[model samples]
Target: MSLKLGIHTGPQDLSMEELLRVWRRADEAGFHWASVWDHFYANPLNLREDPCFEGVASMAALAGATSNMRVGCLVFCALFRNPSLLAKAAVTIDHLSGGRAEIGIGAGWFEEEFREFGYDFPPLGQRFEQLEETLQIVRSLWRDPVTNFEGKYYRLPGAVGSPKPLNPNMRLWVGGNGPRRTPRLAAQYADGYNVPYQPPEVIRERLDALEQACERLGRDPAEIGTSVNLRFHMRAHAGDSDADPPDNYVPGSITGTAQQAIDRIGEYVETGVGGLNIAFRPPINWDAYEAFIEDVLPVFHTASA
Candidate 1:
């Protein structure tokens, strides 16, 4: 199967102008997808309190701006908006993008953001329950003529989300790697599963779990696409003056020179990952982005073609 490549941008510390420039460039460069993260705060640990943009709103703007690249939030917190309303928003953005919209969602993490937003930070299990309900509600609103759902966390009485998504197969992506509920949930509900911030070994384990989930659910494993999200850091050469990696750099990021990035990404592809969502660390690293576009993307694109 062909590999799908995408750029994932964190909404923190970037102006709309910068975000547009990067995404538009990726679109013009023929990247398959472009994503923005959903967050009210800059980062979980950033004490500097950098500027952060709202995810869905940014996705709407991104949808309108890009012509070819698919636009979506990397993963919206399911608790951040009402399920039915989120369905409506997704539909709107899908129309704006002429059917190039993806819905990426996860159970809300980052407890502080929830508290500050006046949302209850419930236990993980309870949050998963909410996530499950949100998935069902959103899917129903998108596909069903009328939806009437009553769940522990959400309720919809004759909810009719209008102007349905332009794409009949609007992609619903579930992000995260919870050992039990998450994999099963994705098998049952999501069109795609994306595990972030993990190495190849961990990703292999999660994919195994996802396959098992699909088996238990009596669904075709091929029905659910698999992808990974990795942080990226690169430079023109090994000892270039501006080659220092980002301070927030964690282990397992796809880092190094152009050839190294090509090899590292290939490892995941070998493990049956069909897609990659890469977030480059600040200061945006156009040098790395340019190199990746020139040297790395073509390897996969040509293989696919």
Candidate 2:
């Protein structure tokens, strides 16, 4: 199946005018969507000292500014806002996009983002539990004109969220790779799954686990969207211990030529992934990204077409 190709909204500080300029280019370039990392920190991947940018709000700005590119968070943090409130915000952005928003979400992970912001950094298991509840509550808030849910962690005696999504079906993509709990949870609630940061072998293992989760739950893994995060670092080879990858050092992010990256996307497509949201190289690497878009995306687009 043909799928969307996109970029992450991290790296570099863009002025309001600059952000609009780049976003217009993204749309004009035929990218299917765009996304940004959710954080309150200044320098997670670099030492730029660019101030904090809220993700969902930026997404709304992008949605309003871009005519066709679907706007969304790379993965919105589950703990950052009340579940229902977040859902309402998403619906509003969806309206702005004319029904082209992807509601990607995940359990909060950055300790600094949490501790520094007065938010609790619950342990992973507990965080996952809260994430599960967050999904249920958010979806309910979107689907039900009014909802009353009383869970151990969240309570909504009366939940009224509207104006509902413009499209009859809204998409919710979840990001995670925990072999035990996350896949099953995605099967239960998420419309899509973002492959977590891992090596190719680890990705295969996680896909197997996701397949098993689907089988046990009587869900079709095919119906659940398949996606991955890719890094665009043309310099670092697989064996470079000294090479500092610009973004997350997820396995497979280190090094590749533009052609290698396209071939890798082919490999991912062969393994059933439907979309790839690439974290391009930093400001200095924009030339690399431009080369990639010119050389890689077209081949994949034509092949998959």
Candidate 3:
């Protein structure tokens, strides 16, 4: 499959109008996918007062705003909402986008959000249990006519998920960078797998684990699409204040000149990932973003074609 280019952004510290503009611009610029992160507060969690939009609602607006790109959240914390409810929301967004919607679920890590929001911050292993049950429930609801499931974290009795997704092949993604269990769970349950902010070598290692997991499960590794999300810190010009990345800068970010950014993305492509998403944080650099659309995207898209 050809490599797909996408955008991932959080709905924090930006107005709804600005967010829609970004998504619409991505659509017009020929991005293959556009996604939002599921978080109650702005990530890297500097302040509790920062305005952040809810994920499900943001996803619906994303579907309504963009016509071409597949819209998604990567991902929703499994413990935050009932699995069945989240599945229904995904189906609704799929229809809203004319059958272009995907949803990703993960065992959430942001403990501050959990504790402050009054959610029980259980141990990691237990959270993964919730995640596993959530995936089973969601998949059944989306694909089955009548769903009946009984798991440790949740139970559904003869439930019907009406008005199934507009597209039967609508994807469900598993997102995380966990070395073992994440990939295994993804091989068993997800149509796609995503790891965010990891360098190419780390990504390659994770993909290898995924392949091994698929082999052990007697499944084809090709069954799951894979992607990585790179932080976007490209510079528009020499003097741009935000040109310098933060002190706690993530490795494998897309930074520097357009050519340099292209080179960085090439490294990820060489790892055999099917897609790469440039993650945008608020206080966006419009010039830098446009430079990417004009100078960088064409290089990879042309190569893929």
Using TM-score as the measure, which candidate wins? 3
Q: In order, what is each prediction's RMSD in angstroms?
A: 1.8, 3.7, 1.9
TM-score against native, each model: 0.95, 0.88, 0.96
Q: Could you tell me the lDDT of residue 95 within candidate 1?
A: 91
lDDT of 3 by residue, 149-260 (tens): 9988798999998889998878899999899999999999999999999999999999999999999999998989899999899997645667687664799698888888
Ordering by lDDT: 3, 1, 2
Question: What global local distance difference test value does model 3 have?
Answer: 0.91
Q: What is the lDDT of residue 65 in candidate 3?
A: 95
TM-score of 3: 0.96
Which one wins on lDDT?
3
Clashing pairs for model 2 are: none
Residue 88 lDDT, candidate 3, scale 0-100: 95
- Give the CA lDDT, 0 to 100, for residue 161 in model 1: 76
Candidate 1 per-residue lDDT over residues 1-305, each given as its tens digit? 25799888887777888888888888888988888888888774476477888988899888888898878877989989998888899999999898999888899789888898788999998989999999999999999989999999788889887888888889898998687788899999999898887888888888999999999889998988777888887676666657555676655577888888888888888788888878855568887788888888888852221
User: Which model is ahead, 1 or 2, in terms of lDDT?
Assistant: 1
* Candidate 2 residue-wise lDDT, 1-305, digit = tens: 36568766652365556566667777777777777767887545345366656887788888888887777776888888888888888999999888888788898777877987899998998888888989998888778878898887889998788788886578787887677787778888988888754656666776777889899989988888767777657533334333355435557562566656666666666666677767643343555556666776676552211
lDDT of 2 at 239: 42
